[model samples]
Target: MADVQSLLDKGSNNGGCQFIGIWGMGGLGKTTFAKALFNKLRFTYEGSCFLTNVREKSKKHGLDALRKELVWSLLGDKESHIGNAIYPYTMSRLGRKKVFVVLDDVNDHEQIENLVGRHEFGSGSKILITTRDRQVFAGIKVVDIYVLEALNPNESFDLLSIKAFKNDYDDMKIRKLANELTQYADGNPLALKVLGSFLNGKNQEAWKSQLDKLQKLPCREVNDILRLSFEGLDEEEKNIVLHVACFFNYYYDAEDVKKLLDACGYSTEIGLTRLEDKALLDIDGGKICMHSLIKQMGKQIVREESLKYPTWCNIFWIFKKSSEILKKNMGSIEGMIMNLSEVEETRVIIKAFRSMPNLKFLRVYGNLNVQLRNKLNASGMMFLSRNLMLLDWVGCPLKTLPTTFKVENLVEINMRYSKLTKLWDGEQNLVNLSKINLSGSEDLIELPNFSKAIHLAEVDLICCRKLQNVHPSILSLHSLHCLLLIDCKALTSLTSNTHLKSLGKLSLAGCSGLSEFSVTSEKQLFLWVCDATINGELCSSSGHLSKINLVRLQRCEGVTSLHKLVDMRTLGSLDADYCNKLASNLCSKFDEMRALHFLRLTNCSELYEVPDNISLLASLRQLDLSGSNIETLPLSIKHLSSLRSLTLNGCKRLLSLPQLPPSISLLHVNDCLSLETLHLPLMTEDREGDEFSPEKFSLINCMKLDGQSIKAVEASVLLAINNNKAIYFWAKWNIREKELQSGSCIGLHSLS
Candidate 1:
């Protein structure tokens, strides 16, 4: 309520009318919040109206009648003409009056536009709309959008107790049952209220039975309200909802789901957006999530439909049903998820897939038992649907895919850790293929030509130890975004014949046998060649490396210089740690990389000195030269204004420090065993008029530090304690006890 008030205040400052949207999933108390806010602010306006059940009322009486009701409620028996000209009528009649309006449970933008129009009310008029769909305020200039969230655990339990026990709060068994019911409600207020009412006088046994039933089926009242949003969706959107509910909801993210649905020939992008707007599903942190009750409702819908038709189920997630269908060769099944780990001795005829011609999505969870896996191989699964869009079979037992299975409509094929030698005999028309993941397929040695898979975006072949080479046709894929070949030890080279225009990420890390790698993808943003055997020139065409941002070449011993990366003007991070054979002048030309922010050269013992031009990296934020042989930093290092973290932990060579930048907040010189002098940044005023100091300073094993360096460390520690700033300081135990006792701090430590 306080949040809504703040929004209203902000809207009032914008002048004229304000429209604030309250959006969330069903039963999340969207309408309840709007009603409470409406009552609180209604008396402040000259005229106010709260229109409830806007979606249902609009459906029954049409937008025309709802518009009339909105006008009449505000006008209140005043003789004013109302008709198709309500937009103008409201403006003319209520133009000078400050009105407050609340439209509850709105699902469509048209409902709000037809009733209120765009900012049509008089000055100071405020409109509050509660909706399940945020898209309802599409073209309207809403002051703010407040997304109502589910109640927390404490709130859920409190609400449940109020409705169920009515503040009785004494019975342990009933309270336990009530707690379990609250968990089932999952913070939904409507579910809590309905369940609480239903279990009011029921005994402990009855409550347990009710909980069991709730687990299987959602409460009718809650399901009915939630199903309204599902029913409003079109066929494609409904299918997406069901897909998430049945299989992909918790298992896959939005991108994975999109690829599968796109292969199924659905407008996945728009359909997912619609579902998100309707609050039927949420894409939180890329994961598609549906409320527990809403998911139950979707599954129930599919179950009800299956009950009616018996043989024409769209999805089969139940292991028993899927196994039965596969054995019986049911053709009506469009999608199926089977867990082979649960099937102990059931003989599922793999050849029956040929009978299910409509099967589009097939995900089979494999058994880890060696005997069961061999049994699966003995079953001779020789047939697969050519219409399949997604084939996610983990631990596949076959040595090769069935020759009868076509790859025309396949979009994604994920057979990780499978005992497969190859995908197919030759390249088929893979025009619709987008992603292929055969990671952990140790026995796989080759890949089919992807010349026809022009739309392929990702190819993950990680840990495929036997794979020797990638097909040359992959270089022609203009839409390839990511190609990972990590730990493929037999992979010797990845040479491209043409420019990969859309390639953004390419990883050849741990490919020990890779002696050569070259690509012409100018748009490549991330390149990982760690632990490879590439020597000398890293790239054959270094002139086209402009937009590459991150490059990892850890442990690439033969690479002597990073001269090729001088052209990477946009390279922000370079992790070339363990490249011990790199020349001292390897980073001499790194000044040309204006965007370089993080440079890690850990354990690179050959690096002798950093060039004076290092000060030219104005954007460098972190400089990690730990375990390097550099004795001293360039005096110009003080010019790095953005350098925050400087780690020189294991530089054991004799050294004296240079004046450091004020922006250096973390300094680690832990094992610089040789004699050294320290030059910490002076305490000065920062941009915000605060005393600047490094948050952490470590010199644990610097046994040869001069007396002046020790005093400087003590002074900085005292300053940090005086200013009450959080600081960490580590030094040998010879420091003065009197200076340490003057002001105590948390991170200050002494090494004995």
Candidate 2:
């Protein structure tokens, strides 16, 4: 349901500020949305960042590199961060000039922060981000959020008509076929667009048969249908994608995945060019993506081929062949790690690195206490002591690094899951570290000086229970992003007043004894941020609340109802599990919110009854009335026309249900079996609280209702009468405990 004519018109450049988000599910016009938005603003920008797949970029190029790329591009791809004297040099080059950036389908909170951030843009600057996650701009004030809901019935028909018959067919025949195709496409325009164009001149029965087959196939079976173009690939071109997936990093330069395949005697440079022409794959950053959907199909074919020929695959003996390439290229090796490697892969890997005597960085599948087997009387450290830049043994037990190496060139040493109980005892200017993950270091207490790693971008000390110091030295690395201290138990006061403007994802999930959060970063998500504090403290007045649980807020003494929460409309789900004092009456007032879908009000003990006006919410879909003292349903509950599921489980005191509207397609009433009376209406009774309204009720299940209670009943109702079942009898007696003197329910999980 969409109007394309108004889409570009609603995009804004008003008030010297513009916030545009291109939103949709995967493959449903997300990139198309970005391209459409770009055509609208092409004349306004001098430089543009057309970075595709923001998620894949960050995973490959570290976050700093991505940010620097943007800045560099704005200044004609020159210097990244200008020195104090050259700061004005870079700004003067870019100032008063508008640069439009389009980060296509960016999927992370941190990527958005790095891409645009809160710093005000210059007068003519506009930053546009396309994302599948609407919450990307949740906390920030977006000038316009163009939500790409599916096409309207007429629009869907028009789009397909243009694609299929292209104004050549009879109007009646075209409309009829388009309507049937629309039902299978389910309003997803991409599928409609693709299938419509493909099936245009086909016979009617052929189209119908395809739709019927599609309906039976599960989601996993949809890969080929989505990427049927890949099946035309010759055996040679088929191996290109398989070679890339197994070992290529995010930006898998075609030349790179090619070298591995070339070594395997499957050299297919001409074949690759042919596949790209067919659109089965595209060159992204000089690497192959095989198209997002096509890649899925290739993966399936690879899996099937792998199982059929166990020793070989799309690339013959991929791992063994890869080991040969790495071994042959070892003369120029700088650093490497092959942790947890299997025996078969290990031997091939060993042969590959055998030539790298000049290697500086190294780690592989071997016990920490074992000495080198080859170079007799030499320590493992001595074997690797030249020109090392970085060393990472992610989940290995390493007691020491190469002490004889020139440690002065060392920048980063990731011993995250290692057994190193002490920091490397070095006094050299450790100038280049930007990230260190000591997440599982059991005995680590303190860290190296901040003066050393002045460029650190992230530091993770998660699960280091003995962590007590806040590490004043951390103030030096002004560019840190992810500061994960999830299970640090002994942390009491977390204070950071540095230039932590770059920080994004912060998780403090299970730190029980921790109390105060003095950290000032761009964004933070607290899993449990309150105090069982030895001093009983609470969180800041209001942190950037995105997705949060109940413990994030301590005693609800100061908080009233959520009125300003309407601005947080991007919120999709909320869990207020233990907030025993919060009332459902206060929560129900959020009916004006159009995007609020999921509400979990599980343990609000004092939440005795749900408001009768809850049906006023046109957007309410998944409602969990579980674990409350709610006794009855209002006839007015039939107004919620969009609700697909109604869960009344564990609302133990619920004795009856409102004759639910037909919009409820999924019903979970396992705990509602105790309800003595389950009366469902056949039509809408929401307008007048008198009888069946006969407009909106399309309920699926109501075993305890009389034929009179269900007005306008259809004849196909299936009735069950088992030996132990007596619905009418229990329907009368289940209302006795409704007047019990129950205590106020605390920690209600209501997501109003």
Candidate 3:
């Protein structure tokens, strides 16, 4: 416990309602920090009747109630029904008072925007938010953010000692026991309390045995607590929470969430606000993070509710279900079966499958047995004999697409990954089939009569190790947008037509023995990983190149200069990952390639020096010169406004990283075992431009450099790199995304 005097000392010594956001994972006591801060703020907030437990009641309270409750409490009114109350009543009062609104357990952004978003309160009227979601506080004005880290081993022992050892830390025996117990808890306060409570009355041996069992305890306990948190939610709020926990999970994209919710019949923000107020669900970072435990509990509740009603989750003799929850045209499925074989495989037996006879987007997909067993067989082709487009059965061990299945309506087809040993359908006039994927089916010998797929957008034969030929009629697919023949080792060349402006992603990597690859596309994400030279004649300078990766194409003899690398503006990442031919300062013209963020010329022996102003491209973040002959960086490297990581692991020619930007906190010169000298300056503060002396940069693992410690780095220009990994990551590093729960089934919330 910090001295209360120190808490007071850190307070009001500043101005305005200090917007403090306390963040942590679900059980790390973020709400506890907010409570502690509230205890300190109570004297200042005389009108404080802290709605102690607002989170668990979110669904029951709804948004209107949430706004009215906070407003009413501040005004000392008890009646909860808001309609009887007058308009602008809470607004006018909050406008005058320096209120402290601590919306604890906020899970959604919309919830916060609904609760306190309308208030035009004065400056000191702080809105202290505590949430598991840290990114939710982005864009909102949070003056000070306190991330609630897990308790340390000592702190954890202290907390447990109070509960188990009767606050006796001086007792040597109890102290040792407390340390052992702390190890089992992994620094979680909640777990420590539970273990301490359960093991208190037991003797030392029982405690040790329990500790062993507790060490094996997983996240189940944490989830149980979360489940209990939602069990406290009101019924209406419960419905809303379950609705979101299931169907609207992936649709957390604001517009998508709203659209799906509207489709499910809740057309207004009322349902969302209703769920928000009870503290059952809060929004953060524009996504809904229904506590993992709460989501599981919600599912349990849904299954129970469905069972009780005996309709929604149909459990008649076979547990069949009908759902409209999946996206209409996507390859999405709903309903879980105990066993696939036991489940109804025939469309006629299932209500959901049988009702939709006019399925528009049918694609062919099945194994070799499904194709060979049905090629001449009459009954096996009945299911796909009508309106079908986009036939993609690439990896489906298919001998060939059946000739008996005369397509009544067909468009795109993908047979790329299928193992087709032979294929032919001499039928004519079935000209509706388009795009085909015969990519990895190396055993395939012939094509299904190609004139039918005249409108085909693209055809991919990538990794079809034994791919033989492409028919001339297939080449006439003028609308083909993406053509991929990557790694077709036995494949030779493309058909005669060279103009394919609609192509977007063309990969012909690893065609070892092949002599040529000739294709003209406007914008293509091409990966030429082959060892042979691509049609050198077709490598002319023109059109847009969104992305180009040339990995291990060592036999490419013609492409010596990169000046012919066209369309720099749209180029996203140029992966010269192992291009030994590339030398530093090779391509100097495209200085404004803002989209180029990752440049890897690792293991390129010919590279000596990078071009001047190469670091001017502010978007570059990761530059790996891991195994290059780079000697010195351009002076303009200091201008790399957005660079975060610089790797010089194998840069034998490189000696120093002086003049590196202060914004750079990570320098992976880990394996640069070469001659070096380093200078270090201790950075007194974290804000940029605080003070950058010539000695602010230092070295790590630089044994060849003048080995200097932080003790000796006192008076250098480069700031002594904080030896603390905690401050290094917590202080300045920013991650774009975190592991999140982005999976939510839509069918669970869809109504009958």
Candidate of highest lDDT:
1
Local distance difference test, candidate 1: 0.79
Ranking under TM-score, best-scoring first?
A: 1, 3, 2
lDDT of each: 0.79, 0.53, 0.53
RMSD of each: 6.6, 20.7, 14.4
Model 3 residue runs over 4 Å out of place are: 1-291, 294-298, 309-352, 355-565, 569-573, 582-599, 607-626, 629-752
- Residue 671, model 3, lDDT: 51
Task: Report the lDDT tens digits of candidate 3 across residue range 1-752.
Answer: 24322433344312344455666555667667667777876678645535444455566767667766776767676553447343565556666777777888776676676776655665556677776555456656644566565688878887887777677455576567668778656577876776677666567677667756543333356657556545654554455566566434432544434543453345436655545543445566766655433455565555555445433332111222423321132122122112112323333223333332343333222332343333433233344424343343435544655665556455545556666775545754556544456666778765555665656666777677776666656655556666677777776665344445555665666766566544445544454544655544334323423234222344444335443443555555555645555434345644757666766667777777787768657777667777777766776777776666677776776775555655564556655556254334322234344233221122434445443422223332223233211112111112122221112211111111
lDDT of 1 by residue, 1-752 (tens): 89988888775533478888899999998888888888888998999999999999999989877776777888874344445554465567687778999999998889887888743567888889999998888878545899898888899999988888897868898898888888888899999999988888778899989988887677999999999999999987888888778656363568878877776678999998888899888888988888888889987887676545546667765343444445554687778666676555435535346557778887777574677666655324446677888888888777887555787888888889988999878768889888898999999999988899988999999999999999989877889989999999999988875666888898988898988877767684688887788877665443454367787887898887654543557778888888876645556666676788998989988888889889888899999999999999988898888898999998989478887877878988888888468775332334221235678888877888877777667777777777766787777634443336535476776554
| Candidate 3 lDDT for residue 697 | 25
Candidate 1: residue 214 lDDT (0-100) = 80
